[model samples]
Target chain A: MKVVALAGGVGGAKMADGLARVLPAEDLTIIVNTGDDFNHFGLRICPDLDTVCYTLAGLANSLTGWGRSEETWNALDSIRRLGGPDWFQLGDKDLGTHLERTRRLSQGEPLSKIVRDFSHSWGIAPLVLPMSDQPVETWVETQEMGWLPFQEYFVAQQCQPRVKKFAFKGVEQSLPAPGVLDALEQADCLVICPSNPWVSIAPILNVPGIKESCEGICVRVAVSPIVGGKAIKGPAAKMYEELGIAPSVLAVAESYRGLIDGLVIDAVDNSCRDELEAMGIHVLVTKTVMQDYIDRMNLAKETLEFCQKLMLYKGRQ
Target chain B: MKVVALAGGVGGAKMADGLARVLPAEDLTIIVNTGDDFNHFGLRICPDLDTVCYTLAGLANSLTGWGRSEETWNALDSIRRLGGPDWFQLGDKDLGTHLERTRRLSQGEPLSKIVRDFSHSWGIAPLVLPMSDQPVETWVETQEMGWLPFQEYFVAQQCQPRVKKFAFKGVEQSLPAPGVLDALEQADCLVICPSNPWVSIAPILNVPGIKESCEGICVRVAVSPIVGGKAIKGPAAKMYEELGIAPSVLAVAESYRGLIDGLVIDAVDNSCRDELEAMGIHVLVTKTVMQDYIDRMNLAKETLEFCQKLMLYKGRQ
Candidate 1:
């Protein structure tokens, strides 16, 4: 089946990678969040786009799930010595992406085209598209700091400030990238990968036509980022708690309530399956924690099968 | 005696390093050429200023006469991998200087202050100053290409293009940086380091009020970059030849005829001493080729002694 996966950073990249393993290169199109994109040291840096690209290319550091494997920090070490920003660690190999991307951007090339070119250069077969060609910066409102750029809150401050809300600046003006609408239109399934609902998927969905395009798809399924009341990665669970909501599979399902027809929750949260079913959402309880490559592939396989079941249920109705 | 040495890239940096070794930190100030500075990959790169700073900080690659010692090419290699401009090789450590300098410049900091801060951070004792806080880019008019930026001509084109002339863009409005005029006014002598007269020393002199300040000084001596009808390093000799002037000690002397009171030439060109004297300029014949640290120190000492003799001769006259 033709699959379109919406992804964020590491967690999303992991899920995207899993989907890539099951789907044909031409059949899978992974749309990556670009809300975390920021300019650092005068170079344009796209965290989620790079993560998805690296993971798909099999160049990601397996241990960290971000950055390149066997990456060198010589540039970062030198930057630190010169008293440049050391909070966001830019490895030598990864810096190539930012440097080239920035150069191209300055030369008037769009981010999507640059990402496309980079993916081709890295021998990536599956299509990886940034959510928008235009910038849509994610700004986080925190209790301590009024409004912090997503990276400043996430990376520089280590996500310490209590979460309030997120604003995807420029999202209203941004159109989904060139192939995004077409991918959604042609896809049999639209899978929202296990990424933060607020920062990651929200920014992508908030783009003008992206959500409406996904709504038109036959089967729309979402993999829960939260399992057993905690996020598998990043500050999603903490953000949920701070926002006065209990972090759970039901909360994740509710976050995507009307848009998604099926929800893929972890085995640990199976008790919520019946409750989710009662709310008219199909629930699939499976192992969602991707501890290894096999785990990623298995979760991906189950998610795809669940999408097929959702399609059958829709036909029966 | 308080001394100010005017310098450019590798050769000039060598002379500056020699002066730094012999003169106390408070007694010496090295004013470097900023004409060769350019923006590459969105980073402000000051070739001559960085060379002088690296040499003084003892971080320069002695063999290559530029860049950091034992530097890794990770950044350049990565840039190359991404098909970015790799013609201008930026080592990982060297990129640190460029990145920080660019950041500070973008933040509206003056180039001179940034250089001063970087020098202090590197533990460089002697003051290292760029000729101007304002940019004065050297554009070379060549037979092959009409006008190429200094780095494009020197590094990218490998100086293959026949020299026509050079224009110091913005030199007319550019003022000598802070402390430069004061250093000249209070200086006992001004030593024009053995750097390219046309591209390096000329740019500094071209700065408004700088050449006039040097003219007001009693003792002004220049060490000849040309020896045995050829430049010891770089394209100075070729430039002289291309400009229809014989690349010799006599030609070098004539280039600075009225501006300098004394000239330091290599021992091989001692035959031109009488001719230089006839032009109302004192000539000192010595070993000007600096192959090692001791050679640099000895050349610096001879250049200083030549200035002292010129001072004595002026007193006698």
Candidate 2:
């Protein structure tokens, strides 16, 4: 089946990698969130886009789940010694990507074009697209501080500030990046990778026509980022708690309600499956946590099968 | 005696380093050429300023006469792999300097301020200043190519293109950087380091009041970059030949003309002493080729003593 995946960083990258393993190059398109993209040291840094690209290219550091494997911090260390910002860790190899991207962006090339060129250079088969070519900044409103830019909150502050709400600057004006609508139109299913609902996937979905396009798809499956009351990674669960929602599979399903027809929950959250079905959403409970490459593939296989079942069920009805 | 040094890159840096060894930090000020500065990978790279700073800080790679010692090339290597520009070599440590400098420049900080802060971090005690706070790009007019930016000619084109002339884009509008005039005013002498007169020292002198300020100083001595009819390093000799001047101590003396009171030439050019003296310029012949630290120090010592003698001679007259 033709699949278009929406992804953020780490968890999303793992899920996207799984889908790439199962599908042919021509059949998969991964739309990465650019809301987290920011300029550091005068270079454009796309955290989620790089994570997805590097993970699929097998150049990602497995330990950090970000940056390149076997990376050095000579540049960052030097910046620190020079008294420049050292809060955000930028590895030398990863800096190569940022420097090139920033150079191209400053030359007036679009973000999507840069990502396509980088993916080709990286030997990545699956087509990777940033959510939009235009600049979209994700700003977080925190109780401690009035409002913090996404990276300042996520990386520098280590997510210590309680998030009041999240805002995607420029999202209202941004059109879906080229091929985004077409990919959604051609896809049999849309997989929302296990990324944060508020920041990662929200920014992509809120991009003008993306949500409406996804709504037209026959089957839309969302893998829960939260499992057993905590996020598998990042501050997704904490963000949920701060936003006044109990972090759970039900909350994840409700957040993506109306758009996603099927919810993929972890075995630990199977108790919520009956309630999800009662609320008119198809449910699939499996080992949703991806510990390794094998786990990613298995979860991907089951998710696609679930999508197939949901498609058939919708057609019969 | 308080000394002010005019410098550019490799040869200039070596001379500056030698001076730094002999003079106390409070007594020496090095004004570096910023004409070769350019933006690469979105970072402002001040080649001449960085070379002088790194050399003084003891962080310079002695063999290459540029960049940091024991540096890694992960960032540049990665940029190459990504099909980005890799013509100019930027070491990881060097990139940190560019990145921070670029960041500060974007935030409206002056180039001199950034250099001062960097020098402090590098433990360099001598004051380092760029020729101007405003950019003064050195563009080369070549026979092969009509016009190229200084770095495009020097680094990217490897200085192979036959020299026609040079144009400093903003030199007409740029004022001498803060402290430049003051350094000249209070100086016992001004030592023009053995750097390219065309690109390096020329750019500094062209900064409106700089050359005029130097003229007011009693002792103005220039070390000849040309030795044995060849440049000690870089494209100085080729440039002189291209400009229809035979590369020799006589050519070097005439290039400075009335601006320099004395000329320091290599021992091989001792025969030209009478000719230089006839032009009303005192001459000093010494082992001017600095192959090591001791040579640099020896050369610096002799040059300073030569300046002292010229000062004493002027006092007697």
Best by DockQ: 2
For model 2, which pairs clash? none
Off by over 4 Å in 2: none
Instruction: List, for all models, the DockQ compared with the true complex.
Output: 0.65, 0.83
Candidate 2 CAPRI grade: high
Candidate 2 residue B205 Cα shift, in angstroms, is: 1.0
| Ten residues in sequence with the least summed lDDT for candidate 1 chain B | B74-83
lDDT of 2 by residue, B1-317 (tens): 99999999999999999999999989999999999999788788999999999999999999999999999999999899899999999899999899999999999999999999999999999999999999999999999998999999998899999999999999999999999999999999999999999999999999999999999998999999999999988999999999999999899888899899999999999989999999999999999999999999999999999999998999999
**Lowest summed lDDT over 10 consecutive residues: which window, candidate 1 chain A?**
A75-84
Q: Candidate 1, residues B1-317: lDDT per residue as tens digits? A: 88999999999999999998888889899999999999988989999999999998889998998898988877677678667788997887788788889989999999999988888888999888899999999999999899999999999999999999999999999989999999999888999999999999999999999999999988999999999998989999999999999998888888898889899999999899999999988888889999999999999888888788888888998
Residues A1-317, candidate 1, lDDT per residue (tens digit)? 99999999999999998988988899999999999999998999999998998898889999999998988887787778777789998887887778788889999998888888888888888989999999999999999999999999999999999999899999999999999999999999999999999999999999999999999999999999999999989999999999999999889988998999999999999889889999889999899999888998999999999999888889998
Mark the regions of model 1 whose C-alpha exceeds 4 Å error after superposition: none
**What's the CA error at residue A193 for candidate 2, in Å?**
0.5
Please give the C-alpha DockQ score of model 2.
Answer: 0.83
